[model samples]
Target: MGDIFAEGVGIAGRSRTALAAFALGMSLVSSAMSFAVDDTPGIGAEMAVSSVAGYFLFWQVMATEGLLDGSRSRGAGFMAYAAVSLITSVAGLLGLVLLILPGLILMARWSLAGALVVARGSAVFAALGESWRLTRGFTWPIVGFFAAVCMAFAVLLLPLGIYAAVSDETANIGAAHYIVEFISNVASYGLSALISCGIVAIFALLVDRDERMASVFA
Candidate 1:
């Protein structure tokens, strides 16, 4: 987990320029969405949107950075990644609603599907299956990683949350609000990118380990 975290941070640092552009674009899009609604859709919805966009942009980054096997099949791989991601997200949400543990397990298990889709040109279900198989022994560790991530996210956003609450109570709608919102959105998107990097790192490590084991057995 520590290695994955370190690798993820390294990836983000090395590709900061591209990642910053992606994060800025996402922040603008999220701001537009909020403006279109005439209200912020609460932090939950914002986080969901950020997560989706982050993975999509991260996949593109991986392709352009030569980290993926199917870089030439970007369009097809993107479509498959989107489809599988939607299903996985919905199913994971359902699992969460049923019981928190199952949802976490499902999410952790299928987390690598997007990486597989873009990196290995896997079909939707195939990617999900491969992710499930790869994550078999790492479920608890992944869950722990996710928990740590969530805590860090909450810490990062806590100031924004407090400010939002205070503003709501005081009806303080002004330039400051917009400024804070923009900053918060950027931070959210940046965190999402980091999470995507970590997942990619995990996917690479798991795939490599699996191959080494297969060779040993063969």
Candidate 2:
């Protein structure tokens, strides 16, 4: 009925505006971790640990203030959502053999549901239930929106991908050739993080609108 995606965009914008620093910090941490992994094997493990810490820290900031509803209950809610995501990711990875689409759908839905859990101060199951309910009549629209976004992102990254391919072919580079590759990877990681944050914001807006509409009706 309502323009759920438009609502998600607005909420995401506000969330991003409020938590820009956190997002930037997380992106930098993730990028550095990726760079470290490419450069050194031993240090890569340490960087990976640091990246996880940074991720949770960023989630704390976004969940506490960006959601505007769960400042006190943020810790529990965040943990719950994180648990759900971990399970989802693991299942998706392991079960990709049986049915790819189910795994992929679970992955996508869990992400939005995790955000919903934080924003709504609900349990992970409840967040998922809400997501299902909100998406009931708008599945195709949501899918189309995601496809469009993905296509746009692929187009935007075409030049970078081309350059990477060209470099690999022309230089015949090995993994030991880390400098340029690391730099390029970091740049790509940052760009991807920014775009991902934008997309997540859009979904957050949709979740917020669904909550508001349900409240009004009730």
C-alpha lDDT (0 to 100) for residue 8 of candidate 2 = 42
- Model 1 Cα lDDT, one tens digit per residue, 1-218: 77777767777777777779777988887777777765546445766666566656777667544567634464557678778878978988898799878887888999999888777788899889989999998898888777787788899889997896788689997888878888987887787777777787787678756767999999
What is each predicted model's overall lDDT from 0 to 1?
A: 0.77, 0.54
The sequence of per-residue lDDT tens digits that candidate 2 reaches over residues 2-98 is 3545654554455454345444554455456655666476356644554454345446535533544645453546566666567655865665567
RMSD for each of the candidates: 3.4, 5.3
* Model 2: lDDT of residue 87: 69
What range of 10 consecutive residues in model 2 has the weakest lDDT sum?
A: 190-199
Model 1 backbone overlap count: 0
